[model samples]
Target: MSIGQSVSKHRFACVTAVCAIAAACGSFALGVGRSIWFDEGYTLIVESQPFARMMDLLKVDVHPPLYYLLLRMWISVFGSDVMALRAMS
Candidate 1:
């Protein structure tokens, strides 16, 4: 590809990134104020549990703990409040 084509691609990528950020900010701002969806509620509950208990719960649902472990760390720092949980995602 030529220099001009490469530069154009970079510009498009940057613009897309900016627009995506803007859209996420707008959507999540309102989302935090709203009630959690079923899965989001379940996530909060699962991640808040003690690790051993959390593992048992995950087994019933047949999910890996990787994501929940990360989320548990995130919640420990930011909290499990709707706003905090929504922000991490």
Candidate 2:
């Protein structure tokens, strides 16, 4: 790419990153005191399981397992706390 294009792409990436970070922080802050919704709780429980077990359980569920698997990675990195869980969205 040309230098101009490269600079534009870099700027776009930076702005996008900032916006994403701000949004996640805002959501986590707003949800700070509230209990996790039932669906969130269910998601957490599922994502917290061992991989094989998680796969087995997901076989019977309608939702895709990829979501839970990615969420499992997120939980492993950040945490399983209410705020951390909220930030995933």
TM-score of each: 0.72, 0.68
Tens-digit lDDT string for candidate 2 (68-87): 87888898899899887877
Task: Give the CA lDDT, 0 to 100, for residue 56 in model 1.
Answer: 89
Q: Which pairs clash in model 2? A: none
lDDT of 2 at 45: 80
Model 1 misses residue 19 by how many Å? 1.9
Q: Whole-model Cα lDDT per candidate?
A: 0.86, 0.86
**lDDT (0-100) at residue 77 of candidate 1?**
90
Worst 10 residues of 2 by lDDT: 24-33
lDDT by residue (1-89, candidate 1, tens digit) is 99999999999999999999999989777886588888889998888788899998999786777889889889889888888887777
